[model samples]
Target: MVGRLVIVTGGESGIGAACAQAFGAERARVAVYYHSDKDGADRTADAVVRAGGEAMTVQADVDDEASVDHAFTTVEQRWGVADVLVNSAGLNMSGVTVREMTLAQWQRLLDTDLTGAFLTSRRFLNGRGDRTGDAAILHISSIHAYAVRAGGADYCAAKGGLSNLVETLAIEEAPRGIRVNAIEPGMILTPMNAKAQEDPVYRRTLEQNIPMGRAGHASEVADLAVFLASDQARYITGARIVIDGGLSLMQALGA
Candidate 1:
């Protein structure tokens, strides 16, 4: 990945930050995009530099088209078109039953989790213009896309849609040499699972359901992102790789 340009949305924290640093370790120029955490973005960019890669932090509200465009413009002006795009900016399930969920609540999640991916992917492709050699788009979806939950209607629906989006984009862009794929993680120990990270007992309770008996780490996911972005995964596209320690496999157990 030496000299490759990469863009990681939500690079301010969690899996996104880890992915940025991982790419940086490969000597890639990383564009760290954050919606609200400028400080976190700065820290991520610094980590990239420390990892021996160039980086810049750009503010981008993925749900907003203008913001997405501006962010892409900034990256292009600073470092040229990105060779890799990681869409990791997303919100956790609202945990509200569909009956009680407000429209605003549902739309908020969809806007960021689904529409945001579309906007960023579009902007990234637009920046690519006609040159698409060795470019890849990675969407950080979730096992919930298929493993349904009682109070995750919004989140699940958005992710399910993202799966289709990735596949469709992969088919449409394959001729242009662009790859599109999704990373579906389950029970990851990111800030999204703050309760698990703060309380070991609670974390253990959840981990019991995972065949691997542990929650996944941001770095672990980042490693996978690095592999997917590398030439090692040149032939992989429209694939939904799961890094959840087999948690999704257990969802139907005891039923």
Candidate 2:
């Protein structure tokens, strides 16, 4: 019920867009960040407006410090300060073994997924006008952080690092009255994985692995983000909430 100001990186589409919509439904003012898809970001902003919330679209590459700084500056100028930040910007790479993976591939994943979070969060914490209570940073991590995929070494490493990074941030920022947490989502239906969804065999295989016997929807992850940002989760910090429909649990069984 709090109409707080919030920032959602990669808000152009996927889970980020869904999170924006969820916050909008609660009438939170949102700053939507998009890297390449201006059209998608605009549509997301429109949806927020339709939900009776205020929204503005900002263009920036999360990995670039200057761009990240500018985006936050723009938000600060317009809204003064934001209370919530959802770092959902990331890049996924599929390739051969560690030996076959080039330095560029590893760097790209780290830059986008890991470094991007650091850059964006650092800018916000330094420039944010509001340093009050109940502020949260929700990093969108992946189950790959714990579970390994053969060709996804770079992605897994970056996510694993981010998972630990959030935990450290939570402990360090707790005294500052800032809360930090992460969400590790399993196979969710989004444009990023639209092709995988179309493959019957792969989709079925993925569904069978989940105890829920289905992939998650973007809205489901968004609901978790909303709850974490709300006062209801005030006591929740330094926690990595998994919304993978028991996929991780199954991994433990195999281990």
Candidate 3:
């Protein structure tokens, strides 16, 4: 990945931050895109530089078309075209039942998780503008995409839609040498799982459900992301790779 231009959205924290650093360790030029987290973005950028890669911070609201466009445009103006895009900006499950979910709550999650993917991907291809070679686009999706959850209608639906979008993009852009894929994780120890990260007893209860007997770490997911975006995974596209520590495998238990 030396000298490669990489863009990682939601790079301010969690799996996104870990991915930025991982790519940096490979000496990739990383653009850390964040939303309303200047301080966090700066910290990630510093870490990227420390890891032996060029780093830049760009603010963007993934759900908004203009914001996504501007963010990509900024990166392009500074560094010709991005060689990779890691769309990790998203929202967690609302934990509200479908019957109780309001229109606002549903729309908000869809806009961020689903529409965000569409907007960023479209802009990324547009930025390339007929020039393409070995570029990759990775969406940090969730096992919830297929393994449904009772209280996660908003998040689950968005991820489910993302699965189709990834497949569609893979076919649409395969001729351009752009590979699109989804990384579906479960119970990763990120800010999105703050309660589990903070409360050991509570976490243990959940971890017991996982065959691995533990929750996953952001770096673990980041490692997979790097691989999928690398030449090693050149032939891999439209694939949904699961890194869930066997949790999703047990979804049908007791049924």
Top lDDT hit: 3
**What's the number of clashes in each of the models?**
0, 0, 0
Clashing pairs in 3: none
Q: Each candidate's lDDT (Cα)?
A: 0.95, 0.90, 0.95
- Mark the regions of model 3 whose C-alpha exceeds 4 Å error after superposition: none
Residue 200 accuracy (lDDT) in model 2: 76
Rank candidates by lDDT, best first.
3, 1, 2
Candidate 2 lDDT over 27-84, as tens digits, reads 9998999999999999999998888788999998999999999999899998987788
Model 1 stretches astray by more than 4 angstroms: none
lDDT of 1 at 118: 100
Model 3 clash tally?
Answer: 0
> Each model's TM-score, in the order given?
0.99, 0.96, 0.99
Q: Candidate 1's residue-wise lDDT over 58-107, tens digit each?
A: 99999999999999999898888889999999999999899999999999
Cα-based RMSD of candidate 2: 1.5
| Model 3 lDDT per residue over 6-120, tens place | 9999999999999999999999999999999999999999999999999999999999999998999899889879989999999999998999999999999999999999999
